[model samples]
Target chain A: MTTTRIHSTRTPAFVEFQASPGHRRPVAAPSNVDVAVIGHSGQVGSALLARLDRTTEAPELPGLQLREGINRSRHLLVGDGSVNQQDRNPGTLSGLGARLLAGGRPAVIVDCTADATLPRHYPEWLRAGIGVVTPNKHGFSGDPELYRSIMQAARKGRAPLNYSATVGAGLPVIDTLKRLRRAGVKPAAITAAVSGTLSHVFTRLSAGQPLSEAVADARHRGFTEPDPLEDLSGRDVARKLVIMLREAGLSQVRVELEPVVPDAWAAALPGQVDTIEALREKDAGWREKIVEAQRDERVWTYLARFDGRTARVGPVEVSRDSAFAGLAGSGNRISIESAEGEAIDIHGPGAGVDVTATAVLADLVDAAFLLTRKG
Target chain B: MTTTRIHSTRTPAFVEFQASPGHRRPVAAPSNVDVAVIGHSGQVGSALLARLDRTTEAPELPGLQLREGINRSRHLLVGDGSVNQQDRNPGTLSGLGARLLAGGRPAVIVDCTADATLPRHYPEWLRAGIGVVTPNKHGFSGDPELYRSIMQAARKGRAPLNYSATVGAGLPVIDTLKRLRRAGVKPAAITAAVSGTLSHVFTRLSAGQPLSEAVADARHRGFTEPDPLEDLSGRDVARKLVIMLREAGLSQVRVELEPVVPDAWAAALPGQVDTIEALREKDAGWREKIVEAQRDERVWTYLARFDGRTARVGPVEVSRDSAFAGLAGSGNRISIESAEGEAIDIHGPGAGVDVTATAVLADLVDAAFLLTRKG
Candidate 1:
């Protein structure tokens, strides 16, 4: 009988296996992924699934099959005659099971869940060589160390991990940064108006609308978070900036976030009034504040900067004709300034299911190519 | 005695070597080059040579000793002791013997020349595993097949070729593009207000100066080409756009140059007058044409685009607040519309010997790294 003792170190499980005797492993098998949706029930998730279902197969990957677990009870299996959808949770495959099926097996995982904790699974899935497409910003921006770890795992495992949907929904800020880096240009700074919800509210306020009315209008347009305050408080912009900063190689830098909470929110119990009602109660005062800004010819913009240190800033007033000015609707604008030279600006829609889904799909295609090439 | 037969094909010479018994020969001794400038003697060349001479050890290869033929001459050697005041015939290796001796060995080449034909020597040098750094735009922008051939030769020969000075004199556009590509985002389009000379003229014209006066002012400031028409005609910007396009994989396509030549020079003899004098000689109608553009509140900009197809435009009117608007002095502005659905805009100093030389040095560092890594 052989007894194998494992040492506890920070190294990966596979690396630790070096001490085991005579464990020859087979080369990873090539995989052909047909479909992958990370957040099965969310807005972006459903949109991606529908798009995949509608796409006609091409020669890039032959005999592609959407591998839903037999335990997925709610997913309706389409195109191919296979196992019953009512029998299992198609999107809930265990790490080992995902690896077994997606390892050397072509597969994609499209993550739409906003749950910050979901990204912890990225490294495991990537190590098993599964392509990950996500709209979750938390994985890439929440912590720089972990973000790099995930990237390293993807590289070591020869998998693709794409997250274009993380910032600016459908806009390609991440991709733009990657290209700039590839071309050998380092960004000096990034000035981005990245929150669709925030942009909408700011626009309404600039036009003399009360902050509460603007918040309500943003909600009607599906631009605001459920609590409304999430957008108004500047956290959304801060999160997006952090993601950009990480890509810019500034990791773990503290991001200073100043609450842009309405005046009434300061007086009300944090949990008692939803952000929408608080802003509504302070409508008169907020209107006056906005009017005063306009009288001074200033444009209100939520700006962030990653200036070689921590990402910093909050809602600030910029002069007209400045890059940050004139943004409307749910637009996202990003300007990157690097040690190399002047800033590079990127702007487009920051939210929208279709655009976000398209971005995710683009990432999936990129991942598919990466995996296939590695094989 | 063995009979030897050498056969040639359309492919590069080094690629055709045979290892068969009768044809096999031992590889030659590797050549140590401290620098390998692609286009070695033009405006940028003179400054580059001066910079290298002042900074590096005469001409010593990184670690190799100076061999007799290799270091016999210092002044005549490429990138040796100093920029020679006298001009030699284009093809001859003039004071190479003295130059080679002054410098321990030629470790690097500062390519200030912009000739397309210069790249023909790259494959041979690369096969010899020499390192090359250049500001020449042609090597990266010319024919795609040729560019690929050069890249393949460099890869197989384990050589390093760097050309950061190809796109934005010293702005780091190429470096940025490379990073973006590496990060998994492909550029969709590239737009730029990219000429110091053109920008100066445009600004002058916008300020109500006559076209002729603007051209003269540009010349006085050393921003115009020796034949200012080249700058005025938008050919320079076209070349830059071609470089960016090729980097983005549109290598096979030729950039269609839409001549934006001033009306006064449209039918003039090539050598009839300096661009400034030629514009001055224009009929009163030309001045009227200039005033008309300004009346409409438009600014003239030399613009180039790679919208899936290579195209160049400008010295035409573009409205204020557009991407090309508001470029000051000799600054360069480049807007890259990436496949990731966003546009990246970069602006900075477009011309200066020191800046361009710095860019060339950056490329040299990059080449050094590539060579070391391959080794």
Candidate 2:
């Protein structure tokens, strides 16, 4: 700090402070990286398309309204002529060309599909060293073996798989978990209202709405999945719970979901939750239960929770003071307890085209920055 | 969509899916970049060192416990043999070396000092293409002209200046605002509790505590700056507001801050709050005011707010139902109004070393990733 003084006529550049090699060349321009957006027909998918196309209709896509100014992908292949939301076979999913699957240079794929079969191709993409940015939860919250496979793929590909939008849309659940893990704080417990649709139902039902009405409203407003019953079955919450647990370092915990409903109705429902018919409650026990909980000043929400030794997903009765109480429509809330016993709560809008698209856009930006590392 | 079915071998490598120029070699392992820690003796700087060294004794740091597993940067320079916390001369600041400034290749300078003079060196470093990551507020919120110089330097250097930890520690306020800006959502308004020390004081004061006791406690725990008056003064909050407004694209807005003096002390205190003697209210009117506010079920906290047309800072009374009613200790909160009327509230720990260091580490990671661009 005291020996390297060189007098200059003009204001000396700060570069004079560091050990700059005066003979080196400046960095070249950004690489010729291409971007391929798969699943371009869905809600978030369409919004991304609107953003890329410089249109104004993606109003529902949270941050899409502001991204038109700085979009840098020069070669944008939307669906590569005919890709759809359901194209999941290894051959079809892998056929988006090297820019999406395998590239000698850095490239990216904005995957928006919810197809369960697509996760089967994650390892291949990873192995090929292609970056993937997606809101699709299938690849992350699926089989525990697959989760490991995805991670291994990332290492093998020497590529980043940014799926921050998978767990809680734009709520930053994944990033926060990663930071907590990075900080050496093992999360002792993570309790979350993970299903935005279910949360919408609970928050509304407490304010004097029928269970069916709340579910229908959430579905009509596009808060629920394609199917309304998916919010009621507790499977979605269970998937999110497993992902949270895995992020917290409990990679082997497999949680077999117990439906939020009672045993009588659970038996009558189908293995799937794509329809209200699967929730066969003749006396409307679900509605009555919600109203009953409200009367006791207890808010009932579909909670996905893990406490180190156990992971469970079900409707839990929380006091009015609970972080989950009075959660607004389509909002997600997560409260994590560190090993040190201090708790941190992070809550935000968990779904909707805008929130999910903005999260996916964030991943896309990460992929863009990482692409310079041409593996 | 029927896809191209060209599968002759076992799970055709997704790598086979890309247009490979068989001539190119695999990416060389992440570049030979070096990292320099400028303020190694400080709390956050030491915590970062502990993380890089894989040690376990950074109890004051928020996230060092989790980062030990993945700390990379092989050529680490703790300090340039003579840099101290308060050395502010341009000659001293610029002596760190090329790797910390204009490197032959990509490199990073992790700035942790709060020295006002250090920011003057930023434009020169940025102009040289050296990456900058920090929690320091001086560079971003000092003079409007300097802010412009820094941005222009980033473009000139083709380097990134990441200061996400500046305004909200690890709460992601800067990132969120930038995202909103990118999405073309001109943020209409932003209201925040930017002072964790003041927030903590208000929260505790509402629960029955003397002003002096609160100040002494915060001082003892290192919540306030070395000078307790720094927390009482509105300077920190005002700086944060300017940064937030600039992020929202209001670069020209000049805010005249009115300090958070309670009604009883508004007319009694000196122009500056750099000493406890300045808070000489013989009857303890300040304490009684907090008590009176509590009686009305209203909580009071220092607030820094901007609503596009105006920016202000002061102690404001918020009802029990308001989000600001009970801020957690040393935590920050920001509520943003999008171009639309929707309000988004983001709150988290704002002042702890761990929180801020983790945030700086995130920017460090970003700088590392951006280095692959090779300016």
Fnat, one value per model = 0.03, 0.04
How far residue B270's Cα lies from its native spot in candidate 1, in Å, is 7.4
lDDT of 1 at A185: 45
- Provide the DockQ value for model 2: 0.07
Q: Model 1, range B1-375, lDDT digits (tens) per residue? A: 001111111112111111111101112232344553433444565555555433222111122221211111222332333434333344333333234335544344444666668676666666556656677767666555566666666554556667767776666567556534323345666667778777777677667777778788888888766777677666667667766655543444455454445434454567554555666665355456556655776555556655555454444556654556556666777766655455545556666776677567546654543343222
For every prediction, compared with the true complex, DockQ reads 0.04, 0.07
Position A277, candidate 2: lDDT: 45
Sequence-dependent TM-score of model 2: 0.75
Give each model's clash number: 87, 26
Top candidate (lDDT): 2
- lDDT tens digits, residue span A1-375, model 2: 011111111211111000111111123333444566666666787777665432122221111111111111222223425432332444443465443434344566667778787667777776776667788777777665676677767655666688878787876677767655444456777778878788778788777776667777888887776766556667777767766766655655556455545444545566665345444442266667656666876666667766666666766667656667777776687777655444556666777788788667767655655555332
Question: How much is the lDDT of residue B331 in candidate 2?
Answer: 66
- Candidate 2 Cα deviation (angstroms), residue A257: 2.5
lDDT of 1 at A162: 81
Candidate 1: how many backbone clashes?
A: 87
CAPRI classification of candidate 1: incorrect
